[model samples]
Target: MKAVVLVRTRIVYAATAFAELVLWQVPKPVVGCTHRFKYRLAYVVDGTCVLRYDNEAGKGDHRHYAGKERAYGFSDPDKLIADFQADIARWNHENRHP
Candidate 1:
């Protein structure tokens, strides 16, 4: 199943623990619901992890962790909400109409 949390017109944040990914998106302004600034954070509970952001394109910004380290950075709910809003604004501007 898929879960989506929409913080605003431009931002959407989603998480799928079973799928091992947390996703964030900022949709294009003119495109409205088409183009997006998409990001995904991927990890395995007992394995390694990879945090990927649009900043580096699809190549991804990678980070590796052993067992327990995988649980370290996934606990901030408030920050996640804030990040959604900020990303929305930035993405909207990038796609804004002329």
Candidate 2:
């Protein structure tokens, strides 16, 4: 077995959307998705989890939105960031937030 190594972290705060995020990348991505390492990305708005993408301990990679959860494919780190940004944009647009 290979030892898991910690890699990188990204953080973002979008005041307009009222969200905070933390993303961690490791040796292997969570198993649910076809990608090698779509480890995790999470966003909380006003203390509520508004968006999330992650591979749970054993559940696989998935996405959560406004309390609903679904399967998600994580391809690359950049793409993950882009996707998260886009989702935030959509939610803000729908809610008429800044």
Candidate 3:
């Protein structure tokens, strides 16, 4: 199997708050995904994880928010980026406690 890193990025929202995004592509089947791509996104505040998205081997795709984990649909890469950013924006609006 061939793997490629598509994106690796981090954005700072504040001195103690930040978000990171990592996207990867695989040409063949691997752990946790039948899709050709996998990604992980996370938002942290004051060293605490508040939001995350990832697709682990045999687990498909999922998201975590406010310490709760939920299944997430894995669509195209653009949608993934949009969703991650939207979640961070929502968190910023709701309870940006840091």
Alpha carbon lDDT of each predicted model: 0.32, 0.64, 0.86
After superposition, candidate 2 runs with Cα above 4 Å error: 1-25, 28-34
- Residue 79 lDDT, candidate 1, scale 0-100: 54
The order by descending lDDT is 3, 2, 1
For residue 25, model 3's alpha carbon misses the true position, in angstroms, by 0.6
lDDT of 2 by residue, 11-30 (tens): 44555234444455445545
Backbone clash pairs for candidate 3 read 31-57, 32-57, 32-58
Q: What C-alpha lDDT, on a 0 to 100 scale, does residue 89 get in candidate 1? A: 44
Clashing pairs in 1: none
Best by lDDT, which number? 3
In the predicted model 2, the residue pairs found to clash are 29-36, 29-37, 32-61
* Predicted model with the maximum TM-score: 3
Model 1 misplacement above 4 A: 1-75
Model 3 spans > 4 angstroms off: none
> How many clashes does each candidate structure show, in the order listed?
0, 3, 3
lDDT of 1 at 43: 26
Candidate 3 per-residue lDDT, tens place, 40-68, comes to: 89998899889999987787889999778
